[model samples]
Target: MGAIICAASLVTYTSVSAEEAYTLTIKDHRFEPAQLSIKAETPVTLIVKNLDASPEEFESKPLRIEKIIPANSEANFTIRALKAGRYKFVGEFHEDSAKGELIAE
Candidate 1:
């Protein structure tokens, strides 16, 4: 019962965007929105949805975050924006074309 409740809660939370989530779509061998502008030091959730036919690994070094979102699936990660700069991320599955930048302000 507890497990089921927890699972349900998680599903509900992800399905409903409580706060402004920086949504990104993995398509066309690139990351849409190209650049993300966010407040510095605030923990923000990045909801990544891979709309392609293959999986994508949303990996960030400065943010120290990584998550694998299967094809036609969605995944998210939360990180506190640090110093103002450009943070780069790439998809592990398609390292060459799938790439993006997050600009913190």
Candidate 2:
């Protein structure tokens, strides 16, 4: 009985500690949502799905994150807790049109 209770507690803790998730779609050389809002000081999982035929490099200097998402493929990134501000990102392959920002508040 004690072991069962401990396992249950562990499960609850795991669920509570899980980070929030957000999805961003790339189509027609642009981001579906030009801006995304998130809670400051909270970790999150950002999933970038590329629907375009060419690969794109998700780069953000301020966030210090960069990843290459293959054509028609998706990639996942773990964004650590950040202060309240705006972090801009752009697709290196399509700098002219593919742009977005993460607003933490």
Candidate 3:
């Protein structure tokens, strides 16, 4: 009985630690819902979906994240817990139009 209880506790803890996911869509070289807000000091999963016919690079200097999302595909990124602040991101392929920021508070 004790062993079973311990296993259940471990599963609960694992689920709690799992990162919460948020999604952003790219269409017409722009990010839909260009601003995102999340809780600070919590792990997060950012899913970027590209709905355009051309590839785009998702980059954030503060988050130290850079990846290429293929045309009409999606990419997932795991972000570490962050402090309360704003992190800016842009698509290298369309810097003028593809812009967004992550607000953690």
Candidate 4:
């Protein structure tokens, strides 16, 4: 009985620590849903999908993330828990047109 109880408790803890996921799409050299909001102090999984025929680099200074997504492909990134604030990101290949912000509240 004690062993079963411990197993249940472990399952609950594992579920609680799992980060929520969000998706962003790159189309026409721009990030769809240019702005996103998430819970503060909670880790998150960011999935970026590139629909364009060319590759794009997801770059963010404040978030300290950088990745190059291939054309018509997708990539996943793990973002640590964050404070209540806004973090800006851009596509290094198309800085002028590809811009977005992540808002934590």
**What's the CA RMSD for each of the models?**
7.5, 1.1, 1.1, 1.0
How high a TM-score does candidate 2 get? 0.93
Question: Candidates' lDDT values, in order?
Answer: 0.82, 0.94, 0.96, 0.96
lDDT (10s digit) by residue, model 1, range 11-91: 999866454578889996578877888767666788888899888888988778788888899987876656888898888
Number of clashes in every candidate structure?
0, 0, 0, 0
TM-score on alpha carbons, each prediction: 0.76, 0.93, 0.93, 0.95
Error of 1 at 101 (Å): 1.0
Error of 2 at 66 (Å): 1.1
Evaluation by TM-score, superior candidate among 1 and 4: 4
Deviation in angstroms for 61 in model 1?
1.1
Q: Ten-residue segment with the worst summed lDDT in candidate 3?
A: 30-39
Query: lDDT tens string, model 3, 1-105?
Result: 999999999999999988899999999999987999988999899999999999999999999999999999999999899999999999999999999999999
Pairs in steric clash, model 4? none
Error of 3 at 102 (Å): 0.3
Candidate 2 wrongly placed segments (more than 4 Å)? none
